[model samples]
Target: MGPSRHDQLTIGELSARSGLATSALRYYEELGLIHSERTAGGQRRFARQALRRVAFVRAAQRVGLSLEEAGAALAGLPVDRSPTATEWSRVARTWQSRIDEQIADLERLRDHLTGCIGCGCLSLGTCALYNPHDIQGTDGPGARKLLPRHSRTA
Candidate 1:
């Protein structure tokens, strides 16, 4: 028999198993989100555990985290060590509120579309949804009202 399944996986094998294109996997590597080693032939080889890391990254992306965020989460892993379960759990907990906030934003946007945009009333300019109490929800229309007063950068 050849190597065990837990042994090194070729780049194509990692891509196939992770359901990410080779290019995307390469991009992930470039972003420091994943790691690999080169074979004697200069071919890329990934550890089997990379499958789980890619899945975690995909899940984070689905919940609206940028690759930078995911990479940051993985950054603390020791250079010679794979991420421990505890470390992953910490990362997940850290992003839980962010995921919740994204869901809330989506829900709010959906409600707005269903009620505001879908409203067929003729007087669109004088709608009650805008500038309630003259507080100036937004200077113009749309979710400009939802803009935060603080900075969004890390």
Candidate 2:
């Protein structure tokens, strides 16, 4: 028989199985989120663990993590093997902080909007809360500053 299907998957298989497009998978690889060993003919070969990694990456993106942040998180996992429980937990903790910050920001925005959205001051530059450029939350890098926890690099 030929090689076991799960022993090493081709890039196409990884993309299909992981529900990510070939271009996205390539982008992930370029960002150092995933790895592959090249065949003698220069084709890529990926272990089955890549399946889990891809799944995690897709989920992270859905949660608004930029490719750079997701790549950094995934890079913490062992490249030669599947991720350990501790590694997974560490990533989870980081995500939790991002989610928490997003929640708090949303609550503040909601409260402020409810209190002042229709006060006929949308066009008033002098209004404390209506200036388009004056965002109402933290104004620096990281979760406290943005709506979604995306890295600036991506």
Best candidate (score: TM-score)? 2
lDDT of each: 0.72, 0.72
Q: Give one digit per residue, the lDDT tens place, for model 1 in 38-139.
A: 877899888877887898789888868899987776676544456678876777787898888988877865665566576644232333443232333345
lDDT of 2 by residue, 126-154 (tens): 33344324545334443233332332321
Please, what is the TM-score per model?
0.66, 0.71
lDDT of 2 at 145: 33
Question: For every candidate structure, what is the RMSD over all alpha carbons to the true structure, in angstroms?
Answer: 8.4, 7.5
Residue 37 in candidate 2, Cα distance off native in Å: 2.7
* Runs off by more than 4 Å, candidate 2: 1-6, 124-154
